[model samples]
Target: MYTYVLFVHLVAAVMGLGAAFGFPIVAKSAKTVSQAKFVLNLLHKLEVLPKAGSILLLISGIVMGLLETWLFKEVWFIGSIVIYLAVQFIVAGMLPKNMKKQLAALEGVQGEELPEAYLVLGRQSAKLEGISHLAAFVLILLMVFKPF
Candidate 1:
């Protein structure tokens, strides 16, 4: 049962983080206003996978922690959970707002070139995304090494 839950957790992480890692790549591919709009729409739809994956990750992680109660007391586990929640806030809360602002900025633009506002928002979003990715990397390290 624990192994099965662990398997689900791993799968959720891959499905969620994989989709997330691909987002900037997809967004970067757009060369025109129309393409940018289309890409943003596509990204909005693609968000479902990560959202579902996050829920699964949370559930499976909690179940595993419950099953192995000692994990709840471990510093690495606690840190991982904290980092996960922080990443979730950035991913679920911050990123969407930034994307919406980007969309709004795009709405007023008249050319193939992305507007300065949109570009600024994109850079901000990219920074947030980078931070989330880094946090995820730290979570992986904590999970793998259980240092402390």
Candidate 2:
């Protein structure tokens, strides 16, 4: 059972990272309102897939941690879960909000008019995404090493 779960969790992580890499290209190419909406929808769907994966990973992680006695005094184990949750909210909630607001701002403007607002939001998104990647990597390393 744990083996099956670990497999699923790893697969989910790969899929999630793949989606993250692809998002910026799609987002930048969004020109019209419909395009923006479409991209946003796709982004949400993609984001949800990873989120589901993370949940499975977390549930299985906790179970495995206890059953295997790996969680004892493991800061990385705890930190990974906490950081992943934070990133989940940031990506799914804040990132989407930023995208929508930028798109809305674009609606009334012309000629590649992405406002300074988007720059701020984009920077924040990048930071969050970077942190998520790092957390995921740390989690993987800790899982593999199990060095307590």
Highest lDDT, which number? 1
* Candidate 1's TM-score: 0.97
Candidate 2 per-residue lDDT over residues 40-123, each given as its tens digit:
678766777666766676677777677667564687677767767777787667777776776566566555545566556656
TM-score of 2: 0.72
Residues 70-140 of candidate 1: C-alpha lDDT, one tens digit per residue: 99999999888888987888999999999999899898787788888888888898999999989888988
Q: Which stretches of candidate 2 lie over 4 Å from their true place?
A: 28-38, 70-73
Model 1 stretches with alpha carbons more than 4 Å out: none
lDDT of 2: 0.68
lDDT over C-alpha atoms for residue 104 of model 1: 93
